[model samples]
Target: MSQTVNALEVKASPASNQTGYRSFELGSFAFSRDEYFAKVTWHVGGQKLSHVMSADAFLRAMMRDVAWGFFYGWVNFDPVIGTRNLYGKVELYAGAYHPAYKEKGLDLTETFDSREIMATFKAILDDWTNEGFDPFAAPDETDTTWVGKKNGNNRLAIERQRQACKRMPGLAGDAELRTDKNGYPVNRAFADVSQEEPEVHAEPGFEDEVHAFSLFAYLSRSDVTWNPSVSSVLERSLCCPTTEEYILPIKHGNDRVEWFIQLSDQIEWEIEDKQTGAPRAKVIMKAGDVAAMPADIRHQGYSKKRSMLLVWENATPGLPELYESGKLKPNPVEF
Candidate 1:
C-alpha cells in the first residue's frame, strides 16, 4: 500500500483592523505572523528544496549558512502582488548549490543574464495572487510535479555552468580565492622584510576592566565580505570571541565614575556600593540585549559570550585623542 502524504498549504486573510483597499498589501505565501523572519523550507519529491524570507533575514541566515559566502540578486517588487510601499523589495541570494562562475574557468568580467529566473519568480507570484492559489501549497509530490520539473531544469542549467567553471584554468583558482577568508592574493611581488615590535609596559597601579557593547550596521554594498582579521582591530574597544568589549574611566573632583555597556545574553548584574558597602540594585538584561550606562554609574561587564561595544565619552576631544594615541594613561579601575 502506498503511504499517503499530507500536502502543505498556504492560507491568506486580511490583516486585522485593516479595511478597504490599499495601494498594496503585505502577505507571505508560506509565512505566518508567529514565524516572522523564520526559515520556510520547501520540499518536493521527498527532497528538501529552496527557502525564502525577508531580505534582511535572508542575508543574515545565508551568511550563517555558508559562513558569509554568496552572491545576491537585486530585489524587484511587483505592486500587483501582496506588498505595500517598500514591501515589494525582496532580496534574492544564491542558493548553496548555485554555480560560482568564477570558480569554473570563466573570466572575472564575464556576465550571465538572470532575466529568466527573475521572470519565473514573477510568474510564480502572479499565478499565486491571480489564481488565488495558496502559496504554501506543495508543488507536487512526484518528479512530474511543476516545482520538481522546474527544479530539474534549473539543476541542469546549474550543472552546465559548473562545467564551464571546471573547463577554465585560472577560474577555479579565482573562485577559491574569492571564498578564501584572507581575500584573493594579489599578483604583485615584492622583496620580503621583517619587523620588530616595540616594548610596552602598563603602570604598576593600573587595573584591567571589561566593558561590552553591540554593533549595528547595514550592508551598504552587495558584496559584503566579513573579514575576521579586520574586525580584530576593534578588540581593544570591543572584545568577544564573536564580539568585542572596552572600558572607560572618568574622574571628577575627588571622585571617579565609570560606565559600561554589556552586550550579550539576558542576565542580572549585582554590584557592591563602594561607600555604603551594601548590595546595589540588580540590573537585568535578556538575551539579544543592549544597555547604556549612566554617566555617574559605574558598571562592570558580564556576559556569557564575548560582546562588541562602542563607547561614547564626555571627556575633552583632545584628551580622548591623546589617550587613544597612547600619550595619556588610562585611568585604572578595580573590578
Candidate 2:
C-alpha cells in the first residue's frame, strides 16, 4: 500500500469565531463562558448535526480531542463524561463498529494520516496561543521544589530539602542547593536544607528580635509551578503552601476541599463541574483573596505574571466520603 493514499487535509472553515466558536472540517464548537451551555454544529455534505453541552464539558473534550489528534495522530473522546448526549466517541477501536460505520467524523478514517490531523490540531492551538487563550497546559516550568533558573525581575534565594521525609519514601531530600549554572553557590546565604536548620532573619545587633521566617527563604527559590507544604496545622489542616505561575492544564478536585490565600499577585481561576467538566464560574483573586475549593468541581488557574499563592489543605482521610455521601456539602459555609 502507498502512504500517499492515506493523506488528509484540514483547515478552519470561515464560520470560525474569534473568541467564542472554533470551526473544524466536520463542525464548529462554541466556547462562551457567560453562556450556560456550549454547542457543536456539524455542517458537512449538506447534512446538519448538532449537540448542546455544558460549557466546561465541551472545553475539556475539545482540548483532549485536539491534543490527541495533534500529538498522537488520532482523536479520542471516550474519557469525557456527559458524552452520551453528543455523538459517539470518534475512534476506530477493535470491534467497535461495522465497516460501513467506520467513517463518522473523519471523511476517510481508514486512509487518514494521524500526522495530517495533528497538523490541523496544531493550527487551532497556534491560533489560540496567539490570541492569549490558553485553557489546556502543563509545561515543564512547574516545580514543587525551589529548583530552576530564576530569570529577570526574579529576586529570591532559598534552600532545598535536606533529605526525604523519614515517613514518606521516594520523596526528595535536601540536596538541591542555590548554585550558578556552573554548580557553585550563588551567595553565602544560599545553603542546602541538609546544611542548616530552619532559620529566622535579624541583624547582629538585634539577635533577640526576628525580622522574617524561613518560609520567605523557600519562596525566593521556587520556579513557576511550585506547590509545596511548609506547615502542619493539625491532624488534617495544613498551611504555608505556595504555588508558582504557569498553571497546570487539568483541574484538580480529587480532594474534598482545598483553600487558597493569595499571597502576592493575581490569578484567574476557571471552575468547573468535577464529574462532567462543566463550566460553573470564573474567579479573579489577588493578594489577600481567599477561596475554598469544593469537592464536586475541579479548578484551573491562570497567572499573568510570576506570583505567589498560599494554599491550605484538609488532609482528613474521610473528607471525600463525607462530601460524596451528602453529609457534607461541597461548600464549607452554610447559607
Q: Which candidate is the best by lDDT?
A: 2
True-vs-predicted CA distance for residue 270, candidate 1, Å: 2.5
lDDT of 2 at 174: 20
Candidate 2 local lDDT, 241-306, one digit each (tens): 554455533345433677788877788898876654558999899988999877676677787765
- How many clashes in each candidate? 18, 10
**What tens-digit string does per-residue lDDT give for candidate 1 at 1-335?**
11111221223333323221011111212322111222333333355433345432322222222221111111111100111011123323222112332133221111222332223232223222212111211112112222211111122211111101121112223212121143322111101111122233536543121211112210011022111111112223322122221211110110122233433333344443322213455566554454443222223334332223322223232432354455544444434
Model 1's number of clashes is 18
**Model 2 TM-score?**
0.43
Model 2 misplacement above 4 A: 1-212, 224-226
In model 2, the clashing pairs are 56-279, 57-277, 137-249, 161-173, 161-174, 162-174, 163-173, 163-174, 164-173, 224-244
Q: Which ranges of candidate 1 are over 4 A from the true structure?
A: 1-264, 287-292, 295-297, 317-335
